[model samples]
Target: MTISAELLPQHVAIIMDGNNRFAKKKHLQKGDGHREGKNVLDPIVEHCRKVGVKALTVYAFSSENWNRPQYEVDLLMKLLEETINEQIPRMIKFQIGLRFIGDRSRLTPELQQLMLQAEQRTATFTEMTLTIAVSYGGMWDIAQTAKTIAQLVKEQKIDVDQVDVDLFAQHVSLGDLPPVDLLIRTGGDYRLSNFLLWQSAYAELYFTETLWPEFTTEELDHAFGVFLGRERRFGKTSEQVQQEKIEN
Candidate 1:
């Protein structure tokens, strides 16, 4: 499953799903499944880095996840704190920039501080950017960006007529990076689940039944292979695209 260099996705986003299902199937505690899922991220990030991916965004915790049982939520927060503490050194060693995109106000003060420290410590890294979405929702991201833009307008910093698709997008999450080239969802899910709505507008979507903890590097290569086989026409016909390629 060697993906052609030209077909490799520059930015890949993942919806990590099926942690609870994986745990249930193993007859283990849900927390254990989450821990395993968290462990899987490091290897996947390493794979992405080795494969020349510029950015990888993972859906870690959603804003709607707070509706779960309190104990589970608490366990998740604890896991996040511990994972952040452990990954900081690895990130620096690998030269991977660590960043979080989401509403941080809901995160514990300690976790917030740790996240900030991780981001600051790896700010100079250039190998790859790893973005974890915690307490994040696509709708929330869009709304927050709109709010910020509205504030600027109110302050007379910008005119309403200046607002366009590009201007609006500049305020959205991950606005400075390349648009998502591929979006992978595991655990048999077929939906985006409110993850990166604006950024994934034209992304190639891949879904799999493999649980997060069990999704392997081989599987990732398979996804890339599939991506390479697709003919991306955007809005043009296949003949038109082929003709343009030939002319170029």
Candidate 2:
């Protein structure tokens, strides 16, 4: 199907799930599913860029994921480091900025340093930004932002009354990027699962039964189509929205 560039999402976020399930279903060795899922992202990233998506943020590891078995957690962390190292060159080639949002204090010193280096190296790229959220959670993101805002207020850098949505927004992750326009989950889950709470406030949601390892660009296209067909009134009435569209 042909997609109209006019209505394409400015930013897209993905909740990649079902790697372990896919592994079990395929009878693959313990951690192969995660590896399979990891490979699926490259094409999707390229597809998003080709379709004019300005940014893509993916849920790589969540704060709660630390509760998983130690071996699995270790494997995931190793994969994340590998992913960053592998993506740096591609990011430069594609002119995409690479970023990370998470509690870095929990990560090893080497990984933290590598993440910072990657962010700084690709800081100026304009083609698109690819954000990987490792050791991240929506509540953690909001709580940290609130803490920062409170500190500023205490320091007299910001007035107590100056705290508002706009002021609070700049302190959150992805604050400088366009708000997430579409959020997709590929594990048949219907919940946000503690990811990108503040940034995806009004994003169109797409859920699919296909596991992360099996999700495809064609599926991504279908999600965009659904987003295009929806009426995102943002609290405006249907009549008012239609009238505004006609005037535009």
Best by TM-score: 2
Candidate 2 similarity to native, TM-score: 0.98
Q: In order, what is each prediction's RMSD in angstroms?
A: 1.1, 0.8
lDDT of each: 0.92, 0.95
Query: Where is model 2 more than 4 Å wrong at Cα?
Result: none
Q: After superposition, how far is residue 97 of candidate 1 from its true place, in Å?
A: 0.6
- How much is the lDDT of residue 242 in candidate 2? 99
How does residue 7 of candidate 1 score in lDDT? 61
Candidate 1: regions farther than 4 A off: none
